[model samples]
Target: MKILVPVKRVVDYNVKIRVKADGSGVETANVKMSMNPFDEIAVEEAVRLKEAGKATEIIAVSVGPAQAQETLRTALAMGADRAILVQTDAETQPLAVAKVLKALVEKEGPTLVVLGKQAIDDDCNQTGQMLAALLGWGQGTFASKIVAGEGSIAVTREIDGGLETVDLKLPAIVTADLRLNEPRYASLPNIMKAKKKPLETVTPDSLGVDVASRLTTLKVVEPAKRKAGVKVADVAALVDKLKSEARVI
Candidate 1:
């Protein structure tokens, strides 16, 4: 069985984000970049599956600029057998990404596809579901635990009220959640080895996927600054302020 895992490169979670001077988008120039935290979890899960003899080959894939190859290398260092980089300089939307992954799925014929629940940069939380829909396959999103069986996979998911268990047939899509196993750091030796791992680069057009953006960004602005709280003289003053100044009453 082959497992396909998609990873993404995003600004470091620890870095403080800044809005562009022009209302365009967030600043990303020369900023610290790393694999999406959730994607790291997905990679770790694929690695675990391979270690358990459930998966024969693990392929790490990334869709972004040329730099995204770095993210795929990180996955290889984590234990993926090989990697693929979908080279595109455009800002890819969820639908476009899903289409690209669908194309790869058709070509690779992996029995399982794993992905992060969401990318921190967009926080859209839509790609996995979209991919599953596009492929007409079973989907297990926000999976906390996964077990491979004879011909199906059982997934324990994190839901609103509590955990929910669902069994999906082979060739399904699973999205990793925070409760999934913690990712292991790539060792120095593995990092060196990853450099030699097979990494193929392909354009989205070559895959016959149109990546045109359907949505337009009107403006990107920083959130309004919160106002400081004022101390009230007494209960009566607080009530008066609430009724008059704040208009809560």
Candidate 2:
């Protein structure tokens, strides 16, 4: 089985986000960027599957600017056989990304496509489901555990109430959740080897898919600062504050 893993580049979680002066978007210039944490987990899972002899090849793909190749390289270093970068400067919304992945799925004919449940930059968790819909394939989203069997894969997903398991046929989509697994850091040797691995670049136009942005960002603003806590004389004061000031009761 060949597993296709889609990774994304985003601002490192440790970095503080700054909105652009014009409110166009978050500031990316002179900022640290790295692979999406969730995607890292997806890549690790794919590598584990391959190591277990369940998968033959693991292809890591990214849909973003040219710099996204770094993200794919990280996947390669983690154990992806090869990497593909869908080079595009335009902002790729979830739908556009799904369309691109769908095209690749048809072309590559991978047995499974694994993706992160959401990108921290946008927090939009729609790509995997959209790709499954486009491909008319079974989907197991927010998967915490995955077990591969002959011609089928069972996924244990996290739900509001608890966990739900579903068996999906081959050629399906699975989105990795936070608790799925811990990702490993690439060793120095693997990082060096990743530089020599095949990294293919393609454009959305070549795939004959339109990647125009559908949503408009009206403005971007920082969250309001929290007020410092105040001390109260007694329970009566706390009740009064909750009833009148906070208006909770």
Candidate 3:
């Protein structure tokens, strides 16, 4: 199996985000960047497939600015055979991203394409489906469990009601969920090895995909802070507060 996984660079989860003064985007000035959490899960899953001998090659593909090479390196350290960075400076929306990935898929001719269900920053949850649509291939999104077969794969999907299983043939797309697998840290040795791996860079223009933002982020503001509450001294006071003051009862 030739598995292609798309990774993303986003602000570190622990870092506090500040909106840009012009309200165009988030402030990246001096902010720490890391691989998106969900993308990490997708990378781990792809590596697992390779370790199990189900995958013959794993390529980590990242679409962003030059800084996105860092995200591809992170995936390579996790065990990808190679990396591809589709260089784009503009903030790409789901439609644009899907188009670029589609071009790569045609070029690589991979059997499987795995990606995160959504990018942490945008939470769009649209790329995987869009890619599948663009390629006219089937998709298994929010996959909690995956088992490879001779020619098809069995995947368990997490939905609103319950888990559902489906068998998808090769040349399919799978979007990973949180419970897919626990991502491993890239050790120092792997980091050194990743630096030596073959990383091919391409531009969106080179691939004939126009990089334009269809969705615009008008404004971003911090969510209102939650109010703090005091604990009642005893059960009687709690009951009184709920019944009289709060008027819940």
- Relative to the true structure, how large is the alpha-carbon lDDT of every model? 0.96, 0.96, 0.93
Candidate 1 Cα misplacement greater than 4 A, ranges: 234-249
Question: Per-prediction TM-score, please?
Answer: 0.95, 0.97, 0.92
* lDDT (tens digit, per residue) of candidate 1 on 1-249: 999999999999999999899989989999999999999999999999999999999999999999999999999999999999999988988999999999999999998999999999999999999999999999999999999998899999999999999999988999999989999999999999999999999999999998888999989998899999999989999999999998989
Clashes of each: 0, 0, 0
lDDT, residue 76, model 2: 97
Clashing pairs in 2: none
lDDT of 3 at 12: 93
TM-score ranking, high to low: 2, 1, 3
What local lDDT score does residue 137 receive in model 1, on the 0 to 100 scale? 95
Candidate 2 global CA lDDT score: 0.96
For candidate 3, the TM-score is 0.92
TM-score of candidate 1 on Cα atoms, chains taken together = 0.95
Instruction: Write the residue-wise lDDT of candidate 2 on 66-119 in tens digits.
Output: 999999999999999999999999988999999999999888989999999999
